[model samples]
Target: MTSVVTSETRFVRSGDVDIAYQVVGQGERDIVVGIGWVSHLELLWELPETVHFLRRLQSCGRLILHDARGTGLSDRPARPATIDDLAEDLVAVLDAVGSERAVILGWVDKAAGAIALAARHPERVEALVLGEALATTVARDDHPEGLDPAVIENLAAAVEQGSWGTGALLPAIAPSVAHDPRVAAWWRRWERMSATPNMAAGMLRTLLDLDVRALLPAVTAPTLVLHRSENMLVPSAAVRRLAHDLPDGRLVELPGADLAAFFGDTDALLDEVEEFLTGTRTGADAGRAVLTMLVTDVVGSTALAAELGDHRWNELLDFHHREVRAALARHGGSEIDTAGDGFLAVFALPSRALACAREARERLAAGGLTIRAGLHSAEVVHLGAGVRGLGVHVAARVAASAGPGEIRATGTVADLVAGARAEFEELGEATLSGVPGLCRLTRLVDARGDA
Candidate 1:
């Protein structure tokens, strides 16, 4: 069967309501796909970037796409729709298409329905992929910080007003879009075609009130949780919690913060998803390893900022940021986070981390920037975004102890580096404040030597 064009609208009978859908690709493998709220299949195809991502997925297998009720071409049934109803729509669509079982790919708000379906009817779902998912609308009661109610209210109002196109919504959805004229225009057009302000607001509220923490363990199918390390929409901790709660779920952290799947590095996302679904990649066996952690910071950044003034300082800081980022990329170090004038990064190998730190310090010194770096190796929690553990903390502390243009390493790291044929001097065992017990540190090179 030839795939339906985006503009071609069709409907599946779901009891009393007709749910609108579009079929794409003609592969034998069937996949039922659900997009987040406010999707216009036709409009989506008009955007080359969005269509490219969809077409690529279609090339691998058939894609069954649908608009959830109350948005797009689907019948806007009344208020207070639950994920259960949304899941029912999915089942109805499958029944209409005569698909016995298929992989389910759901993004953003639809993640709740995807989870609910996988939990309720494991027989119908072969595998599952949820991107930018949320476990609960209200953070766990144990969560120390929940989203501010005022902020949520304002966001809702903005969506309600249909001001998402002009206001912060555009810039917020894809921050990097502002830098690219073509992409920015496409985003604005896509948003306009997708949903009205009220519809968007309603869906936003639906997502906010949703909490699927209780349904996680019931999910039996192989599941992949795709999230960006820097996602501003959903908290990283929440995604971590989802992985922890799901019985067969694995996490893959993509690099960019663009919440829209089609916006950034979609090829990587597709590869990971396909690999997980097929037997080629086992999420359990891959990505788990002990690695060296590194933290680096500009020396006297506040003082320098004051000296250079805000604009000039920001300009210089931008240059510094680019330099450090390029150095990290060249050395195979994954940047974890950027805080003011500092960075947190990780390398899978201790030697790489050590070498990268030395290179970074040397490179920055030439740029009129002074840097200190610390490295440690321990059983690091590889969250795909960055490494975390006591080892990471120790590395940060050691970096703090180092003077400008110096590199330091914890005793654990030093031990790993002992036979690596690198020159180093012991800094002696010292009581690291807040860290338990004494830590032996080594200075990779004396500060004066670099001078």
Candidate 2:
């Protein structure tokens, strides 16, 4: 199916927050894509996985996409938004878009909003498609599939420590593509653009504590609950319980570890989603993707700039920039973006990322500059405009941990470049702040003791 092209973002008033929304199709029915995943509506099209999923749904009916209160392009409320607020916000979004009825499709974690709306305002919902559904999040003996409070708290801590909008949660959410530089880079951008770390943490805590099992039985519309057999974030049994509880719900177990509805066998997801919503299906494929990334930034650049003075600093910065760009091009690295004196770039191979980092540092150091570089290679979503998802966040954090003039990389990158001329020293395991789990870091060194 041909995906929807980029379009302008419009807004509707939902209390104080201006809920951003967009409509992509003019089919006979309406399907409101309830807020799910950390989102940015405009950037969603930039991802093929989401575009494919959305386009297939559009074929079934008109598709309504929106930023929930306090996230994406929507206005931030003075206080943290509640599940009730997000649910009602969906109602206002439907009304604003003139959607009297829609198949409310909710993604994981946000599934409660869809359930709440359907239960209280059944008149507004034609049906429901809940992927990665959960009636309650906190774990219990009977509901062992639910998220544990400690796990939730750890995630909250990671977010608080500046990991929320940077795809720091990628490994937990979608390990299948966790390190893909293309997918990871764009995901990192989404994190930064989605919401502040504090707001995200508060929102997560509120959502985690919310239990809406009582509301499930009240939903009058036909329902479909699709859960991955191996989704790490949300267990399959939890979705099974959800399916059994909803008055008119049916369950379909998909095969994959990816938690994102748009990643991993997206066609299967949209197949079930479209079939449930419109009683038909169009198998839209989310095609191939994988990427490797290396992010470099000058250590103490501000102090260096001050000491060097403006004129000399600008000249030096320009020289470093030109030299780095040349080194990257030489090593088949694509310039992803530049932030001040630093560069965020990509390579098709871990060796290239390593080589470019080494070459760039060597050239810069000779000119009296020092730099820090980080490398990691993994699966990613290669959106034509840009790459996105988890890999970039890990790489950025890895880069931040490096000492001056050192090139630090994850074991994943080092393993990938094994047998290449590059030499590596094990830095052992350390908790990558804002990232879940400890990581085995390694430093890439040349024989002369430079990155």
The estimated TM-scores of all candidates read 0.59, 0.62
RMSD of 1: 13.2
Off by over 4 Å in 1: 1-7, 142-149, 279-451
Q: What is the C-alpha lDDT of each candidate?
A: 0.76, 0.81
Clashes by residue pair, model 1: none
Q: Write the per-residue lDDT of candidate 1 for residues 300-413, one digit (tens) a residue.
A: 999999999999999988988898888788879888889988999888787878877877877788889999888888776444245546877888899999998888888777
lDDT of 2 by residue, 169-235 (tens): 9887777778899889878887888888887777777757768887887898999898889876776
lDDT top scorer:
2
Error of 1 at 96 (Å): 1.1
